[model samples]
Target: MDNMVSTCPICHQPTSPEWYFCPNCGKELKAKLIKIPLITQIGIYALSIFLPPLGLWPGIKYLGQKSQEAKMVGIVAITLTIVSSVVTIWLTFHYLQSYLAIYNGLLTNPSGLSSF
Candidate 1:
């Protein structure tokens, strides 16, 4: 009977079945599994677009992985989150500035209200 064995990609050493890591070179023997599922990916995208702050967790998780697809999703989610945050801050500052200007005008010209 012939015995079956696998070889390590890094060191080319014969490895037994069911071994996850190469004993000779310490490289992982198993193929990297897709950690992020389709439904979860869709949810991440949706959260990034609608609720940016909540999307950060999945974005960071995906970014930490080795998969290129996950990295792309992570980058997109992070970019959207940052863009949303910046837009929110800018809008808030602009509206606040407008309110302050209106308040100042009211204070300086109390009779301005009569023109309305």
Candidate 2:
């Protein structure tokens, strides 16, 4: 009563500390704060490194959030991941079985990997 601060919009009674909506009238007294999990943040970051599609999960979670920065981060990260994956795949295909055979090292050829 004495230590209480503002009054509830509806009831007009004393409001508690940092209460969002007025308990009596159900009026919003404070702004809503959206929170994202740290794991999601880190996961999105990792997703950025691999494939953007892989990050779609976390990106959807943070989509249209109050924090535009986080959305941007997710978007950029995902894009990079996808691009990197594509580039890596392209290089692997360009090299084809030549590198595979060499890396595997088979006894038939100097770098054949049939035994492996």
Candidate 3:
């Protein structure tokens, strides 16, 4: 097996590529970069913006992976999903309350619409 070695920027010490922090300096190591296709990122963001709840599945999946970009997209997707859900629920409740008010008014005065 090949032991890959890397230099730490903070301590200027040799460290293993797999190490998460520098042994000598205790500085955090940079995560290995994972390249994701541009199209995939766009698609993920598009789904997140259009269908936030559905997008959360992909977001959570990516978040569990090691890719930093994927994790970022996942966070954004989760945020958008929560915001969208809140707005939708608020709007639905508001509209339902308005509908109930109209229904109650009609029930209280059946002749209310007779003039119309």
Candidate 4:
């Protein structure tokens, strides 16, 4: 397996894989002209741009619990839905954790570990 350089069709110049378009002629040689269905690509691109999981956040979050990855996504969604502030985090916590972590008892004992 030898690393061979690819030559651009437009300029006939040696190109590296990193070279997206030919630097000489500025023509797209490595560009594969596959067309993604507009609606589907738009939806995914929308999610990636508006949502954080468009990156690799979900995969790492999924390591602990796949549902939590969903929660992380939901958290991002909830944050956007709410007025942005430290209060937005409270909304996210309320949305995700719900009534599970009762505040009444925990407020007095912050960690809530004092019960144990």
Candidate 5:
């Protein structure tokens, strides 16, 4: 197949697969895409769940890419990051509120204290 030459659809000019454009007509000859592996996608998702900040980098990076699949992965990663972050923030606030309530109770009830 190395001896075979592919032709440009627009200008019907012979072109090489390695060439990005047709030399004769200047028409684009090859369409290239940045492909991300499934394993890497899973890794990014895991990071998004447990470590959201780390996951955000790949999410934004993939979103900027021209590939549809990469965009999907990016969207998933970002979504996971947002969801996880929201949950984490909510839990932190909830625990803080609980701790504050306990502290206030201890402060108001001086009679219940025993010498330690």
Candidate 6:
């Protein structure tokens, strides 16, 4: 069983690669951004357009992180959510208005369909 371990620079204590902070001295082990691929970004943005609530997960996740790029992505995600919500609402209202007009016409004259 090869149990290889690395030492922390600050406290000379053994640390595992997966550990972000040195357990003995609280030294930061590694600082890196969790990268998101371009395809995934496009998918998230697409989800933002289709299923807005589902799309908000990435934005909320990135916004709470401590990276500038992540924050920017989060801001963009939230903006897309807002914009999509507004567009969805507007489209719903527009369609509903048209449907109600047709329904009212049907109520006024049930025999109008035979003319077509």
lDDT of 4: 0.52
Residue 41 deviation, candidate 2, in Å?
Answer: 2.1
Model 6 clash pairs are none
Candidate 5 lDDT, 12-38, residue by residue in tens: 887776677788889865454666787
RMSD of each: 10.0, 10.4, 8.1, 13.4, 9.6, 10.9
* Candidate 2 residue pairs in backbone clash: 48-77, 104-113, 105-112, 105-113, 106-112, 106-113
Q: Could you arrange the candidates by TM-score from highest to lowest?
A: 5, 6, 3, 1, 2, 4
Question: On residues 4-111, what C-alpha lDDT tens digit does candidate 1 reach at each position?
Answer: 667887888998746768888888765665556888888898898778798888899889887656887899888888888888889889999999999998899899
Q: Which pairs of residues collide in candidate 5?
A: none
By how many angstroms RMSD does model 2 differ from the true structure?
10.4
Q: Give the 10-residue window scoring lowest on summed lDDT in candidate 4.
A: 55-64
* Model 2: CA > 4 A from native: 1-32, 35-39, 97-116
Best by lDDT: 5
Candidates 2 and 4 compared by lDDT, better number = 2
Identify the superior model by lDDT, candidate 2 or candidate 3.
Answer: 3
Score residue 110 of candidate 4 by CA lDDT. 73
Taking all chains together, the TM-score of candidate 4 against the true structure is 0.26
Q: lDDT (CA) for every model shown?
A: 0.81, 0.66, 0.79, 0.52, 0.85, 0.81
Q: Whose TM-score is greatest here? A: 5
Score candidate 5 by TM-score against the native: 0.64
Off by over 4 Å in 5: 1-35, 114-116
Give the residue spans of candidate 4 off by over 4 A.
1-3, 33-116
